[model samples]
Target: METTQHRVVATGHADWAGTSTQYQYIGPDQNKHAERVSWKGHAEAVRRFITDLLKQKPPALTDLSHLAAVGHRVVHGGDYTTAIQITPDVRSRIEQLRTLAPLHNPPSLETLAAAEAELPNLPHIATFDTAFHSTLPPKAYTYPIPMKWTRDWGIRRFGFHGLSHAYCSNQATNMLDRPRDELRLVICHLGHGCSAAAVQGGRCLDTTMGFTPLDGLMMATRSGSIDPGILEYVQNNHGLSAEQVGHSLNHDSGLLGVSEISGDLRQLEEAANDGHELAQLAIGIYVHRIRQAIGALTVTLGGIDALIFTAGVGENSSGIRRLICSDLECLGLELDTEANTACQPDADIATKSSRGRILVIATREDLTMVREIQAIIDLSSQGPGGVPQVTVSKSNDKLPGISNS
Candidate 1:
């Protein structure tokens, strides 16, 4: 086996199963890269993801000892993760925050531990989804909750999807060739979960999601931005327990609850096609809330120069994009009817004639993790900020720290 040196293995949970994307840049033979293996996870999805990576293509090129570091997508870093790095102390702190982000942090910690136990000698880095929004203005992050709850419990709004938002906004700027400081934009990241952000001069001015992922616009299941009084009312009158209310709000509400149907957008769309009244109601509520958030972000940014649509729903669903953008003509946003209808994923789905640019950029947080890993590697080699470029090695199909079910 040819001994390969460095590579980036980026993993993500799209359908509740982890999939690793390997990127290796060999010097002269870099152009002759191999086809990527997107392994499917069946029983133990996380374990299967790793098991398949090694089986599909053994790491013939890189040695385990030379593999520098592994970078992870660590969501909800709270106040700890401002930048990206790999250290035992950071991992411990991220584990401590599992209570804050019940859905995201704990699983990420599991993946981290798995990686660590498997490759104890190699470094593992964690890049936060909440870090970029760390630049949030106080007015945007502070909630109207009691001071004690916020100060003691860390209960202020810590926006999610900062990694995607930052990547999309920066990519938008680069593509537009505009300086980051001058561009004021509103980015809508709609997926199974949804959030809208107001970015001014590359910093988060305001966002829709507060404190928890549950805050923000209506999602596939989440009830975004609900009145706190509703929970109390449900508990007192309806005789529902706190956990039941939480479950309903987190898993039963939104499109699923409204339509009384499937949580998947495709199902909801099909129901709407069949002229189901509740489906229309569910979609209507979803789009209406999205527009509402856009309107509010307009005030936050004064006036946005560009509008960005990203994530699963934002990048893939043109109908939702059309409905959301149609009403924003007053804000100098108009989608070209033909182009909007014809656009696809990973493409710049924007209108040509619109005064304010509207773009559909695919969010690549996995690639962002690769970059962060390389940066840390460089920092280790050439002191702080000395290296011009981050070095990434190619992995020859080394297995992840996952068990096969």
Candidate 2:
């Protein structure tokens, strides 16, 4: 009774998908196209942009009757979400938690609404970034906040980047042909917004992000893992309100705040190379925080098997990777000095002589979303009594992979 299902995929980081092809479509025959598309920045706008592009190709929008399900990348699930599936109640619950992740949830909600309008009968599923880390033990997830605040208000650590971490962990396991129960892995998902996760026995035991994506490692503009005392100090000393302090932390901080110039890592890298002291300091701080997280996750996991670097900064930026892994020789982790620096995007850049494996896996959250959607569709087609088993792997051991250049 296993029926085949097709998944319609979407992402928050839609820019990561087929950008070259999309650019080609919007480039020469369409400078005018770019101007019209420019105003379409929101998630809803992408649907129209996509429709117009499809219209230009065939000059018509195609029917989506064959689509089994749509998989959406939802950024936050708070404490209530665990897996990807949708019901009226689930969608409403996601909307209710919007205040927790202002930047991410609004677009996700709009996209959800757009999809419902655009494809009325199709099932939409939400794959949350926080769901994987729901496995965190009470100690790791618990904050020192009052029990009432956490229990009633849902104020606690709910990690982000779970989808990417899950994808990388599974991909690494499959690529290495290692059994899940036998592997311990640490995945570093580095980007403009970054986070790390410790996957033991193929489950997220610990991660760097907490409550919001703003907590954890320093990010492009996010003030990750900040102290609560700072807010009290700001309120008293600077006469800043809680909302104003939040705005400053969420928007005006991180690399942009530290460098006092830019949040773009590429720009920071260039400035650092040119001996800009501020840029150097920002880079130093970023690498230092990442290293600290890695160390903590390693301790949490009791050791490491493979350390994976994915996402924008993790895949291509070898210098930063090197900086993060430097002095970890004591931990038996070595970076292939040459392979790291020469690492290419969308490729696994693992060092040859490293004691523990260092891998560069191109994070494919889109593909993960597609797979999850297909799973949900399969489960749904089985009717009320049939629930398909979710085959999640269980090993989180530290086994290295063969060098894949």
Q: Which tens-of-lDDT digit does each residue in 187-259 have in candidate 2?
A: 9999878999999888888888888878989998888988789889989998999899888888889999999
Error of 2 at 112 (Å): 1.4
Worst 10 residues of 2 by lDDT: 396-405
Write one digit per residue (lDDT tens) for candidate 1, span 276-345.
9999999999999999999899888899789899988888888889888876889988888777888875
Candidate 2: where are CA atoms >4 Å away? Answer: 1-38, 41-46, 49-62, 345-350, 378-405
Q: Give the TM-score (vs. native) of candidate 1.
A: 0.82
The lDDT of model 2 is 0.69
**RMSD for each model, in Å, please?**
6.5, 8.0
Q: Rate the local accuracy (lDDT) of all candidates.
A: 0.69, 0.69
